[model samples]
Target chain A: MMVRMAATRDGYGDALLELGGNQRVVVLEADLGKSTKSLHFRKQFPQRTISCGIGEQNMFLVGAGLAASGYIPFASTFAIFTERGFEQMRNGIARPNLAVHVCGSHGGTHTGTDGSSAQSIEDLAIYRTLPNVTVLHPCDDVSTKILTKQLVHLNSPSYTRTARNKSPVLYDGREDEIEIGKGVIHRDGNDAAIIACGILVSEALQAAQELSLEGIEVTVIDMHTIKPLDEALVLDVAKKCGKIVTAEDHSIIGGLGGAVSEYLIENYPVPMKRIGVADRFGESGESEEMLNLLGLSAPFIAEAVRKLLNS
Target chain B: MSSIAELEEVARKCRVRIVDMVYNAQAGHPGGSLSEIDILVALYGTTLRVDPKNPSWEDRDRFILSKGHASPGMYAILAEHGFIQEHDLTSYRVLGGKCQGHVDAKWCPGVDFSAGSLGMGLSFGMGSALAARLDGSQRQAYVMLGDGEIQEGSVWEAAMAAVHHELGNLNVILDCNGIQNDDFCDEQMRMFDIPKKWEAFGWNVKIIDGHNMSEILEGLEFLKNSNQKPNILIARTVKGKGVSYMENNPSFHGAAPNDEQYALAMKELGVA
Candidate 1:
């Protein structure tokens, strides 16, 4: 199931409206209303949405209180600031097992221009390390909407990362078949697997198209949920394909590549190439230029896959 | 409303619970918890309009412990209010115990939010106050912040947000015993004018003896009648209030009392 074009934040903004319509749902934002697109909820449901001016840590704790008081809360902020509030998320929400949805926008290099400080290049890793936290980075608008709704309903603490820039939608909004821990194989093949998440999914699909002309079939999977990681599917693909390539907009060290490699190294050894920010902070540039400069574009992923297959 | 004698009695029992629970487990923050007991007892026994039987009561006043390591005092109050069985508190910090080192909102019945890391309780209180305004519920949120915990920058961020939002329904009681994790708060981080800082942050500030039941009750009454501004009652207290040896001892910050120490403290409170 695939759509044409959409921004993941758009899906989040849309889903927030739907969630806000429910009397039990409450939305909290930390001054970055426009960045996370939570402004839509603020405009539609002024009463239920609160913008706690530039105080991300306060937003996290406040969300906990609101959730405890019997309201489902979605606390939104930029990835960097949200990372600064990790202690609060760990103690107040996760340790307490409160049903607060901690969502972040401007994830990875897709945030553009603001450079390393603003890009949440390590958001996935930070959240995945925490106990009882579900981390998701949806591929497109459709996937983002599904993940947002799922997180809002999950009894445990959850986090959803949203990209700032627009990207091609890989899944149609009508796919009611979305499961939390299952990865969707966008392209099936025997040569290698290109595991991608968030905005990188669209790039992986594009790379596969280019690679296919050279008589290579690359399997691509949108590993949206990072924790409770689709270990079974990953191992199955690793066993079959023998060569795996992971592409994401986050740090190559702890994002999709690390998660997949950890599973493979422990279970089944395999050759893998990781295409992401190679241990460097993002530079100020347009989103497209940043992807190319950081070697996260479709061409870069395709190139990495070529190298992996040859090795 | 609880009388001065009743509040004192409740405070004495709170200290006993804190000491006994800690002594039993050989793990607890007896110092900070002891300093905070009188105020917590005052809130639960006399000031706060909350039902222990219905912990989630919408209109109930909220009490958040920002200095979460001192959870024994809170657990003791909750037990007294019938939120938990008094005997269940013996399980403090034990394996698979609901009574964790910190208050967990999910596992514990009376806990409004999970807290441990300092400087976060006030933010939760601010949010609750905001929620009450949004939902048209008439409720007040009270928070207890350790003097040492106020060093976190997030505390000021929350203070700014709370006053900016004009949450008159919010009241903060800073347990200004002047002690922190390892040393005196003044030595660790000098916050001499706690009231002035809150006042500058646009809160209605009041400084009072935290152990004095009359002052504690008066502060709560004032917060209840305030129109549209947040309030902070700086309760000056000794680190270990009732016990002679533990009083003003920063070493008791997270130390559990031994059998001998516990016996002496309980004797002082007349709990035995």
Candidate 2:
């Protein structure tokens, strides 16, 4: 099947432009609007868009302030830069349970050539620790758009990680399959489940396809929502497959893999191998190079699956 | 709408509650609360347009206490204005208490911003002001900051953004109490030319005695009359204004008054 390619950041921007129709929906940017794809909304709805200007800490609280005053505010910056405002996110946004949607684009080591400083290896881990904050890392442009729009009805704070790099458009015509807290399974099998998120979702699908050719059937789950994790689905797969290989372009400490493992260990234990960055920073390179170097590409995911099954 | 004398009397009672709340709770910040009581009393008692019954009413003026450890003052004033019962003050710093050790909007009524970490309320206030403008509401945001709280770089980020956005409806009251938890502001960080610093940030600066009810009212007037830019009233204050032994004492910045000290405070405030 032929696949289209699109960046998740574009989907974030598309969602903002569509949400602009609601008078209560407002956009905030801290001088990285173009990078985070909020410039699209800023240009069209300059009046409702607030330009916070080179201040991420101020941007989060400003978003919170807007949330408190009956406005749905969406703020964005690079993933690594968003960490600069994590305390603000914790105290102002999450503590108050304000409905501020924060999009941290260019997340993970898959963001090309920006080097270690720009690549956010633990954005997911930090945000997951926050109480009353939903954490999301949608796989494709369509899913990003769908999940972001769902935030309008949530009436709570959320942190979404989007990528600057383009990936295979998985949910192009299957928009209805996408939900905020539920995982989307691309290919299903009983051998083992490959639970992944962000850019690794596509890699997990590719690995599952490759494994199928070799008679090792596998389940491919796009575990997009990291917090308020889909424990029901995770437990179902752990029961069916008996073995699991979790993958992501984030740190293994507390990203997608950490969330899944923590849930399974507590509820139902299973033999699992988390395929992710080994708590190391990325160097200046193409996303493909970084993914391969960090053991997060399709082949690496397949190898991990085989290793898990063998174990 | 209260006269200056009526506001002063109300503030004196709040001062009694500020120390009493700390003493009953066995732990709370009384020093900064005593210094900020007069301003909180004047703002909520007379000028701020808020309904205690409808605390979440849209278009109500948003008040953010950035220096939230000084929450005793806010809780006392909130009780005086009926946001909560006077009995709720007993829950200060206690678990399951609406009066959290810090100012939190989720726990308490009429609190617009949940502030505990310093240098945050101004930015939140700016957001509130912007939201009001977008909704075409005439409500303003009042943020109270401490002298030491401005030491955080994020505060400067908000100060710059408020000026850049020309947020005329954003008002700030800095409790220039000179002392922080560890020591005085001069010892911790010399913020020389404090008013000049705000003026440099393009804000309309006003200085007043934060303890004086009439001066605090005048400062509120200055905030109301000023427009087209952010405003800040750099109110000079003592860390522990009402209690003699605690006055200008850094140790009292975050400490609860002992039983003896509490009695002394009540006697000094003429509530004995």
Report clash pairs, candidate 1.
none
TM-scores (chain A) of the candidates: 0.96, 0.99
Off by over 4 Å in 1: A1-4, B56-59
For model 1, how does the per-residue alpha-carbon lDDT over A24-65 read when each residue is reduced to its tens digit?
Answer: 788888888887888989998987887788888888988887
I-RMSD for candidate 1: 1.6
lDDT by residue (tens digit), candidate 2, A1-311: 67899999999999999998998999999889999999889888999998889999999999988888789999999999999999999988888888899999999988989799999989999999999999999999999999999999998899999999999998878999988899888898999999999999999998988999999999999998998899999999999999999999999999888999999998999999999889788899999999999889999999998998888
TM-score of 2: 0.98
The Cα RMSD of model 1 versus the native structure comes to 2.4
Mark the regions of model 2 whose C-alpha exceeds 4 Å error after superposition: none
- Tell me the docking grade of candidate 1: medium
Error of 1 at A148 (Å): 2.1
Candidate 1 lDDT tens digits, B104-139? 776688887678788889888887887788778888
